[model samples]
Target: MASRLRTGSADMAPPISSGRGPVLWGCALAVLSIALGFGCASTSPARFPSGRALQLNVPYFPQQVGLCGPASLTSVLNYWREETSVEEVARAVYLPQLNGALGIDLTHFAQKKGMQAESYTGSLLDIKDHLARGIPLIAFLNLGGRVFPVGHFVVITGLDEAREEVIVHSGSEANKPIPYQTFIAAWEKTRYWTLQVLPPRPASL
Candidate 1:
């Protein structure tokens, strides 16, 4: 079962549904769980029709501590069939002062490599559109509290309409599932910052 992590400091964490554990409860269930002290129940993840959701076979890289940017970028780049490594990406973009690569730097790095990378949308429909096209996305979020906001980058590998969750590659976790509402809350904190990197365009014939 996934732990009930708190959204305390700057960076992504718990309390929000991880989609791995079934903890969501109706009002009465919440009160009952508290009274019984049994905590939330665990159940199988809700299933969706194939057309409604899907997970791509994107490469996942467990980010080195504090290197979500490089790790996330590597996932998508490799998805496009480009060969790379976390260290290679980090060397190209990581910043020592911030201890993380900046969003702009990530985009620039992709562009320099001849890929079409940019911020496309904050809309869920758009996200689904990209995923349907066999593309993974990089989302920037503030997983921490207001006073100690922690910025984080996660790769969106899939989404399930039935479960309302967005699957991600976060930190050391691969294929971590985050509920849509929970994802939106954290994503909104970062003003819905997201990146999409596509394969380089073919030159005109």
Candidate 2:
């Protein structure tokens, strides 16, 4: 049987443009990096770790607001509601409800950070392209073994450019952020992961 092309349901909406191609995904990844501000920090280089691991003082969800809050979510929604583009839904982390998707709280957290909340449906290749830039990525893991696609939501925070590796954030309150090898082993199974780019909010000053 012929292999079927996997399309990302999250980013692929109607009003399709003619410019659609692999390049479009690249452009999107670039935009995601710009919006996320990977290397835009003012902190001195010496203070920063050699690895791109971001030191998140912000606590984990539910335990701490982490990046933003309810007010932030309102702000993100207010700006994105009118637009046809994706939206970011940010909120404080809460214990999983009956839904069982822990990612829901992260979505809420993204909204609070004033990012457009949307998910992408693509394979690890697409994700690797995005992470190649500064854009952070959220990928699902298999947890079982190396499969075609995975089933866990984790974020790619840093990249080992030399080694062609990535760092993932697995919403673990106790464990430290995950390393590239550990994340890839889990993600290789399903190749199922979500990607999002957080645009900067308007300056308050």
Model 1: per-residue lDDT, tens digit, 53-85? 689998999887668888999999999988889
Tens digits of lDDT, candidate 2, 155-187:
444444334355544433422445445554554
User: Which residues of candidate 2, in runs, are more than 4 Å off?
Assistant: 1-100, 145-152, 161-164, 171-182, 188-191, 200-205
Local accuracy by lDDT, each model: 0.67, 0.35
Misplaced by over 4 Å in model 1 are: 1-51
Best by TM-score: 1
Best-fitting candidate, measured by lDDT?
Answer: 1
